[model samples]
Target: MIGRLNHVAIVVPDLEEGARVYRSTLGAKVSEAVDLPDHGVTTVFVELPNTKIELLHPHGEGSPIAKFLESNPSGGMHHVCYEVDDIIAARDKLESDGMRVLGDGEPKIGAHGKPVLFLHPKDFMGTLVELEQV
Candidate 1:
């Protein structure tokens, strides 16, 4: 069902500052902030093999990102996204295993047009998991 660790998302107060730190301090090659209006965020992606570090800042106070930042003071590890060959199959597997998905039906489009679904953190021992079809 799951393929690889895709990315660890981080909610940041400043996207630019986060990108600078990841690039200059950690020596990561950072991408220009990618505005995902549909998701209500401006994200900077630090590409890594089979995984990445996504720096996210809220587009506005009403955005979900803002609430996430408010909930987790450290703003680290908002979600652990997994890469899968088949997101639909992954969702089915999770459901059959008695996991509660955060949706009613079909999965939705995610970053970069990838199909994605969220398996409730309550079901995975408090780890918010995102399954993405790449």
Candidate 2:
């Protein structure tokens, strides 16, 4: 089952500008950009009192974010990540409940270096859900 809200991911055309808006304009604490080649994204984390906001930009032409940006040129909320005690168990439970998991249906290392899995957007009321092991 899902735990606390981990982070909300937002796809942005430019990571720097996204960070700037959160940092300088909003007066938020933003982390340095970290390139996640495996995930095909360059990310910046905006620290918050309760949760974090992740700013994601396409790392390559083949990046999934690039594909997302094609449809949503302005970029927007990509996914909402929730923490789980056991990712594999959570995945199995969701699967048995008829929820479809994305990708190969396996956990991948996320930005926080934690195991994470993505669920189909349609399964969760049109919003993509990401489960990260806490």
User: What are the candidates' C-alpha RMSDs?
Assistant: 1.5, 1.0
Show model 1 residue runs off by greater than 4 Å: none
Which residue pairs in candidate 1 have backbone atoms (N, alpha carbon, C) closer than 3 angstroms, thus clashing? none
Which prediction has the highest lDDT against the true structure?
Answer: 2
Q: Estimate each model's TM-score.
A: 0.92, 0.95
Worst 10 residues of 2 by lDDT: 60-69
Q: What is candidate 1's CA lDDT for residue 84? A: 90
lDDT of 2: 0.92
Candidate 1, residue 104: lDDT: 80
lDDT tens digits by residue: candidate 1, 21-123? 9999999889999888888889999987657999988874477678788887667778999889987778778888888889784888987698888888998
What's the lDDT for all of these models?
Answer: 0.84, 0.92
